[model samples]
Target: MLTFLLLRQLVQNAQSSSSSETVYLPLVTQPLIQSLPDAQQNHIQWMLDEAPYPALSAQAITVNLAEHEYLFLIGGGEQFNPQTGRLEQTSRVTRVELDENGQLGTWSDTGDLPHLPRRLHGFTATAVENMIFIIGGLNYPAGNSPIPRFNNKVYCAEVAENGTFDSWKARNQTWKINADTSYDYEESMAYHAAVFLNGRLYVMGGLRRGLYFSQSWDATRYVFSAEIDHSCEDLVWEQEETLPVPIRGHSAVAFERSDDKISEQAIYLFGGVTNDENDPTAVSYRANVGENGLEEWTPQAVIPGSAGIHAGTAVRSDEYLYYIAGTTQYDPKQNSARDNVYQTKILPDGDLQPWKALNALEYLYGHAAAVSTLGRLYVIGGAIVTNSTQMPLIQNTIYWTPLLFFSKESNPVGMVFPGEEIQYRFTIRSNNVRDLPGLVISDTLPTDLELVSAPNFFQNDRLLSSIRITLPINSKTWQTYTAVVTQPEIPVTINASTATATETVLPTNTSTLTAPATPTSTPPIRPTDDKTCVVSEVAPDSGTPRPKPTCTPTPVVTLSTTPTNTNTPTPTNTPTPTPTAMPTAVPEPVVVINVAELCFEGRCIWKSTAVTAPNRVYLPQIAK
Candidate 1:
């Protein structure tokens, strides 16, 4: 009965929603708590006994980049057997196909590793074209051997066109360092991070554990790089600059951006275990890949939510990087895993924006994650801690979710005046490995605005009533439409647009423009005192008004003659009248438009504010 209950609980947890609270904690020894109902106690006990453990320290990579790509899961500790009280690791290799509709097929075992005992874990795999490279890992000997050996060998295999891997072959040449000494430094490392870029293999920090109980484990900050020859036969390892701090159980990825003029590449390192084994560092770093080697490492935004996070997987899709589930916290008494997922946008200038959290999933750690060609994220085997005994149960399951990227923006986002033309730009980029087809973008302009011009691909209906277009994929398609604000009576107008792919889900975005009533000025009241003179004389040449002199009393003139008899004109003694200042016409107030970019979750839109206009309120349109 107990065994049956445990199995039932495992199945139920696996089928639960990704947002469900899957982490469990051990019970406390309190008398009041122990007095709780039996049903509640049984529920807690079920979570402890039934939750399936995750496959820890596995490596997953997508291969066979044809119409349908296959994701391969290789070498990890599968699960713990409660009866035997032992954790079981496997060397078996399995793969699943991703269909055209972005659906994953059932996982099937391909074959086991080509070595004695045929079991390994904590390895890193990189797929270059049709070839797959398996790096350093820990190998456990067959039978009841208590000690596991660290593997320094490199394995190569060719993935067949039909999504099957051929026979694996170990590289014969030893890693040559300085041509004077042939050393296998990688053999002493496991759980490190590795990435392949520009025909080079780069490996970062990992821990070296002693074979005996008396020897202490040491985490190293070493970094090494090897150039892959054209024939892919010979590789010479060269030591590069070490990391600022020694780390282990971290994840790394390579990003490359290219244009017509120049190409640049950089490597990013995520969270890992540093000097303290129990507490993981959330700090990340980025370094440029130059001709000589990696440049100086610069720190980036820290991962949020949890500080002691390690054994997580990081994958890049387009300009975004995702960090999947990991052990959230660990201690001698209790260890907890979490389903938290975080992502960050990679800017063009090689800087990372702040980390943003995504929807949660089942608690997992020491798992492997990959992004498929269909633009879907897949999380493979990982372990989960039980609430009763804190034992880990390896989970042999897979979960995936669809991913899409869409953004809409407008030029001159701020307050638009009457009779002014506004340009709206719609951009759709595909993060999928292949190009997507039949992407339709549609927008409806407010009644107060008029459409000026749009791209040839767009079909404008009745002077900005409705504009729609079908865009191409894998590129930023810009659609420009000049919208003229015709009516100033309407204080604010919103233009909402939606992008929908053939078989994809997307959100709607809106751009708002507030055209406050054109500033009006009242004509300055002219001064009309009783002494004022009215000008009504008409000019003979043009039909224009001529001003006549104001009526004033004449004064008697007096003159004084000089001795030389020179007739010097006497200075005018008439009292100078104070000039009356004409009333200054009031100028129209200047309208200052304040444009701001507002983002919620991953979607962003343009928001405009008229600084001169007061007490005006505008709200964003929420997508259902």
Candidate 2:
């Protein structure tokens, strides 16, 4: 009996761990706090798990365009044990793909990397068109050999014609990987950072050596230095400003904005580990980092939630930068465990702030890679925490989120469909936004919507700031375009002064209902008709189908009585037909219209703000 019960328990456990089917986390009708317990709602968000290549972490990650997928150059080979499970280490490389449908592909091994495997390193794509740049990492030796290998090699490769990798070309000779030069402390650097900006790649803080013993403070003197030429290809080495403090296994982000038509600018550095990789509170900094040594590297703000490592990916959308994912300090003090996602935004003035939590990740990611297309940020696989030294199987997991903005400058896009005519009205409100009152509103419609009339312009001259414009649409089919409101740029190198122009359109539902009473100022209202009429595109079950109506249909009829002011017709007929005229009856037309679409600035849906009567139809018609 005891043996039978144990066997049954094993069977149940195996069933519970199956990944063949998805187990959904019960959704809250409204967003709720994670602490509040509802037994039905609790679930594990597992995006990636055991796969063929499980031991890879901290390898180079980049996108393969021809395949339209993401590839990870990981460390370690797969390890399997029937009793316990699979073990992943930091000695293998793996590739994760994202197809056109915005889904991640299965984990497949690319042929072995040209160089020996390593982990806890940093890599990023180059801005020189389409190339991937991989920097230094710690190489872990496999098998009976207890020797360790740390790589100072810098590799460069491009996505090529065939679907396979070209040879790994060396960009520069290897050098010591440390932190920004301004700090006095450093640790064994495993996970450092590198980013490409202004035609140069900037390397940030990370571990310089492995922490073998508990007393590692003396080992923290390594500072992260800037190296413009590690590849030996470019002999020019320039150091930007040092980071606020020494950080290892931390992430570096370089944000650029080119939409302003001005030169692109970058919002640099953020969170990572300091000298004590296992302790979070000990790794703190107190310096401000500006562009180059021209400005001091300062810690302006701390990331909001728990700090994490190997969890950073820098993504730029339009004008904002999002630093996402990583684990916190591995020890017990800072956190029970590091969460997988955090978000931060750069202010217009260029300052770093604390990170806020985003949606929970499926698993822990460190040393991951990312690429942005359209509006989604795609994060490839990294490592899940298994043990201190033991690397688990590299599970192929992909995670992402839509790029959303709450900025006042966020513009709604307009779209038109093929072969369809649509009229549009554009309105602007400047009641509260003083800086944007007089900005010009300009937009282009899709091919289907032809501009038949100039935009209707309105302004509250008394306010002196607010302005509005309306455009009549004649669109033919489905399409979309961006509606931009820009402050006129004046040529001014006069004082070297700069100001971010402000622009805002009013909330759609808040428009005023009142209009001026002048003949030219108000829209015409149709006269009301009280005649009994019933018309529908759908015919009644017992009635004959009626003729369809044209633009306007009138019912026709004859009256038995004649008014004194109106003409009276004489009676005539083989059977004396009365000719007294009453209101003329015109045949009302019945029209069948299909609502192919209803859209707003981007996507369309019915608005709850206003409602029209059911009696009204697109084409006017009289019912008999």
What is the per-residue lDDT of model 2 for residues 450-483, given as tens digits with 9 covering 90 to 100? Answer: 3333323222321111123221111111122222
Question: For each candidate, what is the lDDT?
Answer: 0.59, 0.39
* Best candidate according to TM-score: 1
Write the residue-wise lDDT of candidate 1 on 1-624 in tens digits: 232244346435644634312222121111111121122110111011111234667788888555557877777876654555445777767776765434567666444324223466777888877777777778766765556677766777777777775467676434434431222364646778899889888888876664455555555677788777533354566777678777777899898999997688999998777768555456588989998899888888888854666788888866778787787554411466877778777887899999877656677788888766434567777777667475676676667653323434555544455676666654443332223444444455555556677654344563221133232222444445666666542223222122222333234334343433433543444444335345554323242434555754444333323233434344443544443444332222112222222222222222222122212222222111
Query: Which 10-residue window of candidate 1 scores lowest in summed lDDT?
Result: 41-50
Off by over 4 Å in 2: 1-52, 59-101, 104-128, 145-147, 161-163, 174-189, 209-237, 258-264, 277-294, 307-318, 321-325, 331-336, 352-354, 363-367, 385-394, 402-624
Q: Which sections of candidate 1 miss by over 4 Å?
A: 1-54, 81-86, 109-117, 172-188, 209-215, 230-234, 278-280, 328-333, 388-390, 404-624
TM-score of 1: 0.55
